[model samples]
Target: MNARPGSFGRFVADADAAGNLVVQPRMGFCAPHHMRTGLALTKAAAATTAGTLTIDSYTRVGDLAAARTALGEGAPLNGYPIAAHPAACTRALLDGVVDDTFPVQVRHGSSHPEPIIRALSAAGLDATEGGPVSYCLPYGRTPLDVSVDNWSRGCELLASLMPDGRIAHVESFGGCMLGQMCPPALLVALSLLEGLYFTQHGIRSVSLSYAQQTDTAQDEEAVRALRRLAAEFLPPDVDWHVVLYTYMGVYPASEAGARELLSASARLAVRAEAQRLIVKTAAEAHRIPTIEENVRALQTAARAASTARPAAIAPGGSKGTGDEYTQARTLIEATLELSPDTGRALRAAFARGHLDVPYCLHPDNAGRSRSFIDSTGRLRWSATGAMPVPPAPTSAGRTSVSARELLDAVHYVARRYDAAPAD
Candidate 1:
């Protein structure tokens, strides 16, 4: 994989340079043929696309023993176990489908990602997504320090592989903390922090991520904030882009409802000036989406991107994005001042309450931070806790999160889309 511009990161960069929105599916399958077919469908879908090999849970948790057991027993694991799959099979899945036009990224939520990274590297892949804090705090009990060390090695391996045109692209999952409910400022701060970490560890190309949040306007501001911060802090040599995830919260139970929400996410991506999108399917609310469902989502989002208008981005230090830009930067500066090393600073930041996530149950998390939906449906920090949230208009009508309020906030998108008059 001596990519001189052949890497997935470059592929998306070219699309963005052409002002195209690159859409992708969160697709994975246990079978080689199924995974290959998914990539083929994603590549052939009527959209600017990329391929994804989202690894299964067992592999994600580093339970390769169980992954092997499941594979041997033919248990229906949700995703392809790249770390355990025969390298030939995994490589075969992408042989022709993963060319210059159709680059692929391996997505796995692993705190211990070395084996996964090694396997992907062996299969000639250089692009993937995850981060120390983002993948650890929200998903599991993995120690933050341990995850940082593992990712440090993982990033070095990827960066070391930058021979030829193979640029290592690492997308930070930080911005989508808890998928929803966390304030955009914290999300942006974390994502930027992760990008900086990647750069520090040697990844040259990184995609700062922001999930589509509650209010469309708020999300636009969040993306704007993300882009601005990346431009300001990220080194130019570390080529960076932005990727938006569809609403990662509770999905609408109805197909019509789910499609509506998916379209909304695509529009969110385009309007926010994001270059890439991670799409979810109508079957998301029910079960794992089939490849056809994923392809349909890709098409729907591509169509949405085509018709979407550009978002109005307010200038920095202003309330254009509800002061999220200012607040997120504040967090980053505070964290960087912790220590010279990115990993140590991240660990110290979490330990010292300089960085916090709302509603996250991990032990390393400072569970004090709390967020709630405002009357306008924008996610607002009800209690900024230790992280600083500069005064912003979005915080004016912040509702207190009771059990009922929390439930409604979680279902915000689903209810709105499901209640829409069906087509």
Candidate 2:
């Protein structure tokens, strides 16, 4: 199936050119009417915004029958069931809302996204996000090799849409793996690798993601590293951008804290020159946010971004090369040298402990990597496993992070934010 040309990539590029931070909500609904309403509201929001149709879990795991039964029973779903819903239904839902100014991306956490891609393409949508490693490691027990193949197939399917005028844009979720506490270097490395994988499969436009970490300066360095790496590695023709995911870790219980944290993310995006921001609402600590809540969050982020200083002079214009950039470059270059085929290289990287995600317990992951929040709030590696990156400067010759320490590190952001003064 071929998609019509509604360029989500172009829209974001336009926003970046205008120095506007494109804020997007992780919003979804099971019912078509509600979903349509959400998109409409998002498009009408008082900010430069994009739309999202996050796929439901049942459809993500390929359980279409269960999704259908829930639909028939009028049961609410955590997200939109894109695969189970008719293509025509999705088309209708997207019809009036998604356009040049407000492009929509289907956010589905599926290792095997062929069906989802096919359905969205048929419905005239041309953007989505996920990665072979990102979608596989955290979501389920799918083997890394199988997940790699599935994403390869999915990218090929998206590429097939190009002959008819659509250039599908895919965003890499690799940077947000395990949501928090992973060092910025590995996050940046994974995102660049996945973007390369997408390009290797013929995707012409892509976005590399990075989640906001503990320190603002550290996060800025990571985003700069991402842009620098993308420039050095990705093909010249690939239209690419950086996307910042608002702190994906534990949310603050207080509304003020959540809003403050969200505003902080918006500022980070501006300072770091990210083209888009995936926002989290004040209700993040409680439950799924309503349309009003999402809109409020978008507005808040936009306001915050407007007050921020734009990214420094040029891409990678920051001072000396930081450890994050050095480590990420080493990881990416090492992986690329492993095999001409990116998928095989990724599989081999994990197998050889060259690629390891901290706190990720997937069967394929090398569990030796460990990280902790340093005293300065920067995420520092406690252990680097067999990865070629250098040892953490703060390791103090200690080789491991205790379980209780790990628990505290996981909730560090939430606790700090919650205890902060009201805005």
Candidate 3:
């Protein structure tokens, strides 16, 4: 397990250095054979790819007894219950499928992931993604302070695995908070904050994520902003990369529209120099895609990416500055000054309304901030709340968004894409 060619972070770094944009799927299955087949198909895809083992909801919510009961009853669960299944069984699933060229990461949305980490470790896996705030606020009523303590201990546990020769990599889910229309600057700030929190808790390898937003130019600026903030704030010794998720909000009902949106995301990843992309299938608006559908989506994204040219930024680096950069940096520095401990600082930031999510209803969130999609398709804050950053020029005169406007903003991308012809 000692840092090898197969380490998740190292593999991505090497691929980025070689100018290959890595694409991955949010795929998992209940049956061992099915999960193994899914991973094998992902690795064999026509893209520079990675594998994911998404955990079931029961396990994510710490309902292991229910997970076990479903297993015993032969009822199909939504994803692999790593905590409920035997370690040996997981090992068998990954035995020959994972290699130096292919690395697998467990994706579970959990505020309390210590047990999941322990389970993954026993099966000889190390990389996983989630955050104290990101996983807590969006999914349930878990208190922010409690989630912070849980993640602090969980990160330490994952870091301890490094001594066994495995490279422990953690990706912060902070950037994808509330799925859509939250404004890019706040998303960027949260992602960087969570990345800093992971480093404080002992994770040396990390990745910051940003989801594609309403406008391509705005999305590009947000990704570059994230990279710049990482350079300014992360420990120099920490290994890190940028990952872009396909638009996480409403998907277009038209297959053609969905394909266009997915393609647009791949192009954005290339322009922003993101090392990896988490793709969504055309089936996203309907149901869980079949393995064959996932493979097709991976290949489609790969083709779109190959036709793209990297932005003027240097390979593996970015130096662009925009409004997003200024705002995100201001928020991050303000939060860091609150306390030496990142976990405590995050809790304080939220408690004081310094870090507020636009539509998030978590008990910890201030819930005072609001965002809207402007006529130009850029996400702007309609209310800055108590945050340190000022509202952008487009939002200067706006103090409120009507319920009808909010619904339209959420469906903005979908309607636009669906209206255009696929060809």
Clashing pairs in 3: 1-165, 1-166, 2-165
Poorly placed runs, candidate 3 (over 4 Å): 1-6, 313-318, 393-396
Tens-digit per-residue lDDT, 1-423, candidate 1: 111366566777789778789999998899999999999989999999999999999999999999999999999998989988988888887898888888889999999988988889889888999999999999998889999999999899887865675788899999889888988889999999999999899888889999887898888888989988988898876777889999999999988998888888888888878889999998988888888989999999999888887765446544234477888888999999999888999999999878988888889988877777878888877766677554234434553468888888999988988999877
- On residues 1-423, what C-alpha lDDT tens digit does candidate 3 reach at each position? 112444688899888888899999999899999999999999999899999999999999999999999999999999999999999999999999988799899999999899899999989888999999999998899999999999999999998966455678999999999899889998999999999999999988899999999999999999988988888889888888999999999999999999999999999999988889999999999999999999999999999999998778558754658889999988998898899999989999999999999888898999999988887889988888899987655535768889999999999999999999768
lDDT of candidate 2 over 220-242, digit per residue (tens):
99998998898888888888889
Question: If both were scored by TM-score, which would come out higher, candidate 1 or candidate 3?
Answer: 3
User: Candidate 3's C-alpha lDDT?
Assistant: 0.91
Off by over 4 Å in 2: 1-6, 311-320
After superposition on all CA atoms, what RMSD does each candidate show versus the true structure? 2.7, 2.6, 2.3
Ordered from best to worst lDDT, the candidate numbers read: 3, 2, 1
How many clashes in each candidate? 3, 0, 3
**lDDT to native, each model:** 0.86, 0.90, 0.91
- In angstroms, give how far residue 37 of model 3 lies from its true place: 0.6
Kindly give the stretch of ten consecutive residues in candidate 1 with the minimal lDDT sum: 390-399
